[model samples]
Target: MRILYVTTSFPVYSETFLQREARALIKAGVEIEIISLHAGENSFEGYPVIRFNKGSLLKLLYLLPLAFFRRGGALSAIAREMNVRKPASFLNFAENLLGFGAAIVLEKRIRDYAPDIVHCVWASAPAAFGMMAEALTGVRFSTGAHAYDIFEHGGDWLLQEKLKRAALVHVSTDVAADRIRDLCDSGKVKRIRRGLNALPQAREPRETCPSLRIVCVARLVEKKGFPYQLEIYRRLKEAGIDFEAKIIGDGPMEEEIAAGIKGLGLDDRVALTGRLSEEEVLEELQWADLLFHTGVVAASGDRDGLPNVVPEAMASGAVVIGSPVSGVVEAVEDGVTGFVCAPWEPERWVERCVELQVDAELRRRLSKSAREWVEREFVADRNTGYLLECLEVVSG
Candidate 1:
């Protein structure tokens, strides 16, 4: 069966989990194609993409009335949902209208491809687009709701419509699924963990080094708690802990993070390796003794459902110290597999890192357990097999 995957971004440096799952589905005998609202820097090697150019707002305004006439019933349904269920603000209304126009464009693509199923990777604008496409074409659609898309609001009026109409909604964590159950039918929501591409193999012990090699792989965003992590590193250095810290990934907060590092006088010890290739990330992880990922709830209520880097870090046997904010806590296992601390507790975070740095035996024990746990639960072939089964069940 042919499955069309729709998302806001394609070939993103940070969202390789989507590609991994699509590739796994292909291996399971399902033909897959991607349609993205915007294209990114890296290109997927084999999979084909239908990229929608973000045309000017004037052009979009001109097309909005045409889209409304083409899918008037769909627009009316969204309006009813907004009035009765979740009242959308003016901003939400504008965004939804824009998404509707995009969906009309996608409908033409869907009609041409005539896929067996439509799957949206994000439940925000992309899901709204999918909802409109399904309405216009009578083709079944499902959505994979990630962190921000599920939690944050953007024309949330459309979400209930999508939920009621979608054949299935896949969430990466039970925490996310439970929250979604409040908005839609409980039976339709499924928990499907995003799986990793590789499992680490047995290797010789990492040789002892003079300084602790610590790394953090995350976009420099408010929720990532990069500033908090830097403060903890500063205190570690002030306490005379010998270590070198490297942060991977970049975002709008690069200047803020740089300023924070400078303010704390951590420039000598800490470095921001802005946006590296996947190969470069693996190379950095190879020598790193610890992966400190501190995630927090942003002021906007955006938080991680589960960062793919958490499992990848564990698989690499980099003793993880993650934040116990959301679904991240489920993966860390507190003291067993790795350490978990409150996002607000810098002293505690520093204390744990220092303990792990000094005690090689403890690090080795946790790393072994972490890798074993990830290997057992996070295999793409196994997880995507279940995903395909869900697709079949829902389609039936």
Candidate 2:
């Protein structure tokens, strides 16, 4: 089968799940092509990529005239008010007008390639373009809704219409699937959890450290609860615990988190190692005694459908302690694979950290179980097969 995949951005550093799925599909004898907004490079794992130059200064200049003028509602409505005759063509005229122009080039490519299905990875902007392309070409279209796309971007009638038009709707967690089902048909929604490749041989436990090393692999954002991680670190310091905390990933909250680290005088104990490549992140996961994730709903109402980091950490043989929110509970087994803590309570997080810190046997048990769990359920091959099954059901 031939599949055309569409997404907002290409070569996103941390979202290896999408890359892994595409690779798995291709390896399974499916022909795949991806079109996305270029981030930096235009290459990924031998897959054909069409990169749209949205960052060009000329495109920004083109956007300037439309930026101040276009208001709310349907793009067709905005174009009608602006007296543009081809309103549907003028839709998405600002913001991503350049991408729309790129889509024209992409549509020609699609016609030449003639894929069996068009699969969009997000519901907001990409789905709009994918649906339009499908309508024009008569190819079957589908979408996978991540957290932000379904919860934040799906309230609009336009977005809802695009979703309804999809042959199937995929979500990473049951929570997200249930929510999307409320907005669309339950029969059309599929829950396919994100998966990770098996880790290389588990690292031997560190021999020299006096206390355990706790690591978190996530973007330094408010929703990721970086401040809460800092507070937990502070509590551990105050309690005179001998532990090291490291955070990997970069975002807007870097300065704020750094300030918290300084204010708590945890410069030595806690460190933020900006953005790391997947290899670097895996190295951290392999070395750490435990993975501490305290994800919560951000002020903007953005919540995780499921944080991919949790499964990756678990797959790498680290015991994962996560927040008890949304799809996190599905990833963690609480007292089995890892502990779940309240989002705001640093004391609870610290308690779990200390529990694993003091008990090597407990850590060993959880780590062994975590790896086994990932192998049994969240391996990339199994989950990607499930996704293909969903696609088969939809296309039929």
Candidate 1 per-residue C-alpha lDDT over 20-65 given as tens digits, one digit per residue, 9 for 90 to 100: 8877887888987777775653346756777766674456555557
Q: What value of lDDT does candidate 2 attain over all alpha carbons? A: 0.73
For 1-396, candidate 2 gives per-residue lDDT tens digits of: 778888777768867788878778877788788887545247787555777765443543544344324422333442333342222322333423433344444555678888877888877556766665664466788988877665542332244566677899888888887777866787888888777655557544443447878898887777788777788888888888898889888888889888989998999998899899888888888888778888887765667778888878887777888988778888798889888888688888778877777677777788778777777768777888888888876766
For candidate 1, the per-residue lDDT at 183 reads 78
Clashes of each: 0, 0
Per-model TM-score, in order, reads: 0.91, 0.86
lDDT of 1 at 227: 72
Regions of model 1 farther than 4 Å from truth: 41-43, 56-74, 84-95, 153-157, 204-209
- The positional error of residue 93 in candidate 2, measured at the CA in angstroms, is 10
Candidate number of the best TM-score: 1
Q: How high is the lDDT of residue 194 in model 2?
A: 71
